[model samples]
Target chain A: MFLAVTGFAILRLHSLFAVVMLSGVYSLIAAAMFVALDAVDVAFTEAAVGAGISTVLMVGALSLTKQREKIPVHTPLLPMVVVLVTGAALIYGTFDMPNFGDPDAPANRYLVDRYIQESPKEIGIPNIVTSVLASYRGFDTLGEVTVIFTAGVAVLMLIGGARRRRRPDSRAGPEATRE
Target chain B: MTFVLAHLNYWVVVVLMMIGLYIVVSRGNLIKKIVGLNIFQTSVFLLYISLAKVAGGTAPIADERFTVYANPLPHVLILTAIVVGVATTSLGLALVVRIREAYGTIEEDEIDLQDDEE
Candidate 1:
């Protein structure tokens, strides 16, 4: 219900502001769902990331462009077909899934329980999930952070190529006023 | 926690996750795509927090006789994920801004057509 409504808001809206606001609503609901699951910490993070910073950045992006479409739009049929097929395959695969939260599930028998029990002693943190993500899964986290850093660098390179104008008539700079 | 973890809500969250992921994958509008991405990320947060709960555990606060509080680990990990999500969204939006500035279009399909024209 929440997702459907938000998706409708985002997809139906032509205005960038409306789309961004709808996205905020989507995030806020997600955060609430997280809290309902007893994940207070996750809720906090969702609010900060999904509802706050991302919305601001989207609005900023909107400021740089026309909010309304200036060209004819075609429905993306190829991607839609591909996604639908993949989703069907995924649903078929899930028939083999262990029922949700089944105690005898293979995952429960694995290291997650062990980490929850021993992390307090080994890492001495109140949050076992942190110990797993930072200490045990430190290598993966390092990789993730590196990916973010590399992405930031890549974007800088792409957008910062602004000094040498590709064309003399590309007058979209801050100083250029449309008469 | 008792009823929520046991039944109904769990399935709802799962459905919400799938819908979010679907929108993110299927949308062509860059901003709509980002909104979908937010939904996808939040669904994972729900999954993590749900898994972090203990059946009869207390909240993880320093109180006497409440040694077996629900694990605080999921919360901390989610906090980090949240920060990462925010940064990614902002970067995505910033890229959209630059794309608009350079190409004067925001729709992915339109941008591709423009590239073909060039």
Candidate 2:
């Protein structure tokens, strides 16, 4: 589909700017796909985070680095073989997975019933997803927020300062400032 | 034919995953590798959403008109994951910036050569 095509474009393009834009497009298409697959909440998050924030961050990163990818000197044969084997293995494993969208699949069974049935009575939320994410899995959300917080702190520490280097050969910038 | 149709979504996802993997493993550019990693992670999100489908289901929002709601668990999980993926991506990019500042080049082979000489 669109994702496959966009992914291919990203792979083939040497220009980091184009690749970054395509990645944003890929994320938007993925958000559309999520909407089609009954995941509106996920679609919203993907649209904002994947397409919006990630794209900006990448462009910022690209500004700090080279624009064009060098033509790889080594043949991609080994990586090609590895990807083929891994892909084949994954496709083979999919045979055991319940057919796409089967309601009775393990993924749709079990705690799902509890979340759907009990959530209304227990959480008093009209939206089952909200109930589950906010109440049932509140701790998980807290942890996810914590993860984002940690990442923010890490990014700030990594690149927040505009430290000056006396010489290009001076190794003190990254090592000395890094803690 | 039915089998292929049934699993068509998965096959596409697998292809996307492979492409991402190839980019990561084959390319020397650090930024390119990070973009590859983004592709890989997005495909995984697709796989999860695909699995959450229930044929004749509406979005996980509960409504009286709709009896079937797609799995809510995966939606919740993937929502968190998307955010986390961005977090990790920003982190990776930060490291790339640092690497560029430190080494004066972002090519893996060039960095390797520099390391070998030292």
Candidate No. with top TM-score: 2
lDDT of 1 by residue, A23-100 (tens): 888888877866665566666667776788777777766766667643335565765676567656655555455544
lDDT of 1 by residue, B1-118 (tens): 6444354444555555565665666555676677767776776676666655655554444334555555565666676677777767767776776676677777887788899999
Recovery fraction of native interface contacts for candidate 1? 0.32
Q: What interface RMSD, in Å and to 1 decimal, does model 2 have?
A: 1.4
Q: What DockQ does candidate 1 score?
A: 0.34
* Deviation of model 2 at A4, angstroms: 0.7
Q: Which stretches of candidate 1 lie over 4 Å from their true place?
A: A69-104, A163-169, A173-179, B1-27, B44-88
Q: Give per-candidate clash totals.
A: 2, 0
Give lDDT per model, in order.
0.65, 0.88
What is chain B's TM-score across the candidates, in the order shown?
0.85, 0.97
lDDT of 2 at B85: 90
Question: TM-scores of all models?
Answer: 0.74, 0.94
Alpha carbon lDDT at A74, candidate 2? 90
